[model samples]
Target: MWSYITSIFGYFFKLQEDEGREKLLIEELIDLKLELEREEFHNQNIENKVQESSQQSECFQRTGFVTHCGESYILIDGSFYFDTSACSFNLNVNDKILYLGYNNSNEELVIVRILQNEGIGWENEDDSEEQRFDVINHIIVGIVDCREDRNVFIQGGDLKFNLDDVQGTFIPIAGDWLEMQCSIQKNDEKLTDINMTQVLQVTHFRPLRTKIKSGTVTEWSGKVGIIDNQIYFDSSTFIETFIPQVGAKIKYLRLIFNAMGLPQPKIGTVEEFQGQERPIILITTVRSTESLIQQDIKYTLGFVNSPKRLNVAITRAQISMILFCNPHLLSTDSLWNEVIMNAVNNNRYMGCYFPIEEK
Candidate 1:
C-alpha cells in the first residue's frame, strides 16, 4: 500500500509540472498562430525561440514620470512600467524619481534611504545643524522692556525682515543665525527716565560679539561716566564694570536688569564691541511682551547701522544719553553700578506684573 501511495504522489507531481509547461506552450502557440496569420515573421521556430523571462534578472536604469508611490512601492510611468526594486530619493508629495532596478521583482525606490547622507546628493547638508544659518527679518512692532547698560527687549513677528522691507507672499528659506549691521528708522516706541541713552546707537552682529560691557557704571544723579577703573555717578552711585581689553569692543556684554516675558533685555554693560573693524549683530532675546510700565523708568534697545551702528533705541521720543556701545570706543570705565539684576522666576508675564506704575 505504501509503494502504491508513493507512485501515485510521484505521478501527480510530474503531471503538475507537465501541465505548467503545457500551459506556457499553449499561450506561445496562440500568440504564434496570430503572428503567423498576420505574416509578421518567417517560418518561425517558436520552440527554439529563447525565453527572455529567465534573463529578466538583468538590471537596468530608466527615467520616467512618477505616476504613483505607496509605502515601499514605486510605479514608474512609462511605455513599459517596472516595479522599482531598490532606490532612494527626497521625494515630496509629487517628486519624480529615477529608478534602478535589479531583478524584475526585486526593485524599488526607498525614499528614506535616499534621504540618508550617503544616498542623497549635496542636499544632505540641509539635514545638519552646525552649518545651518537661519536669518529672520521682521519690522519693529514695539519694545517690551529694557536692561540697564543698553540691552533693549523687542516684540514683533509675522513680518519679513527683508533688505528692501518689501511685503508680499514668499517662501521661507532655512538658515542658522542672522548677520546684520544696518538700521531702520524707529518711530513710535518711547523710552524715558533712562540713563545710558547714548547707548541709543546699538552694534551687535556676531555671537562672540554679544558679550559686551561698558567701561563703567554711573548713577542716575549726575550724567554717568567712568574714570580710573571706578564707577562714578552724579548723585554718587557707581559699580565696578569690567575694564575690558585695551581695544575692548561690544563682543562681551553683561545684563544688569530686564523685565520678564520680554526677549531682548535693555540696560547692559558693553564688555566688548569691535566697532571700527567689522559688523557683528548680537541677538540677546527673541521674545515679545504684553505688559509694560511707562509711569517709571523703561528702556528699549535695537541695532544701529545707517553707515555703522546708527541709533534705533528710541524711535519717536527724546531720551538722555548715558551709555555708549563701541567695541573700540572711548568711554569712562566706572559706571558699572547701574546694571539691573532681576532674576526671572517665571517665563510668562500674564497676570505677573501689571506695571501698576503705569496706572
Candidate 2:
C-alpha cells in the first residue's frame, strides 16, 4: 500500500534529476502569472538608451557627517562616497566635516578641500557636564522634545530620562533616533525618571537632499570690472519668485543693462546657485495659511526647512539677506519657528499679525 501511494505522488510531481517538485511548481505558477499579464508599455519617443551626463560646474562647500569610514573610501551622508586615500585628517564615522567638492558625471563627490581644517569640534569647549550616576545601562530612547543648550525629554522601555547632561557636541532634535549610555536609578519600591548622563550617539533620520530641478541659468559676458552674476532662488519660493522670472530675461538685457551700468542679478533655483555667491540674497517663502496645496508637506517645504539648504542660502550672501515670507506659514516648522523668533527678538521681523510670541 505504501508503494502504491508513492507511485501516485510521483505521477503528480514529475521531478527531474536536478530539480525539486516544489521548484517546478513555483516556476509553473510564475509562468502562468506572466502569461496573464499584458506586455509593458514603453513610449518610443522617450529614448531608452542611457544618456551621457551633464551637470553644472559647482564651486560650493557642503557640510555632512561621516556616516562611514572605510579603509580606502569615506562615505558622507550615507550617499556621497569619496576616495580618502589622500586625506590628512584621521577621519572617523560620525565626525562632522566640511568638504568642498563637485559632483562628477557618475554623481560621485570629488573631494579636494578648499578650506583647511573646517571640521566640527574644532572650536574650544569650556562648559563641563556634571552628572553623578548611581546606575548605568545601554539603551535606546525616543526623543519627545529638545531645546538647544537645554534638557531633552525621552521615553522608551523602562529607561525614561529628562536628559540634562547631553554632550554639547552632539544634540538630537525632536523625532531623532538616539542611542545612549543612560545613567539611571531604579527604586525597589517604585519607578522614577532615568537620568541620561551622556548621549552616546545621535542619528537624524531627516530626508536626503532632493535633486529637483532648480530653474537657474548662468551666463558669462566678457567685460572689465563688471561681470554677469546669477542668483539662485529657493524651491519653496520658486513659484512666487518674481526676481528669477525677471532674471531669466536679463541675459538678452545684459548688454542693455551693462550699457546703463546696473547691478544685474540673474536668477535660477538654489541648486543652480551651488558654487556661486552674491553680495545680496533675496529669499521668499511663498507657503501661507490662507493658501495651501494638499500634498506631502515634507517634500513641499523641504527646500526651506533643510539646514544644508538654509546654510547654502544664508552663507551665499556676503553682506545682507532680505527674506520675504508669511511668518504664519514659516512658524509651522520648529526650526523655522526658532529662526523667526530670533528675527523677532532682533526686530528684524516685518510681518502683519504673525504668531511670533505664541510660537
Count of clashes, each model: 86, 1
Worst 10 residues of 1 by lDDT: 335-344
Off by over 4 Å in 1: 1-156, 163-175, 186-251, 255-359
Per-residue lDDT value at 196 in model 1? 23
Give TM-scores for every candidate, taking all chains together and pairing residue i with residue i: 0.16, 0.28
- Cα misplacement distance, residue 166 of candidate 1 (Å): 11
User: Per-residue CA lDDT of candidate 1, range 167-231, in tens?
Assistant: 11222223312222212111112211112211111122211212233442321323433221222
Checking candidate 2 for backbone clashes, the offending pairs are 216-268
Top of the candidates by lDDT:
2
**Per-residue lDDT of candidate 2, residues 1-359 (tens digit):** 99999998887666553367678789999997775452212211111211111112333455666777788787876787776643456777666676655444576655543123335542223321222222212122344444434545454212223334232224456665443322222222322122232221221211112212132234322111111221211222222333333224333323222211233465666666788888888877655554452342546554344666666666678888887777776676677778778888888878687654756
Error of 2 at 305 (Å): 4.0
Off by over 4 Å in 2: 1-260, 289-304, 356-358
**Model 2 lDDT, residue 167, Cα:** 28
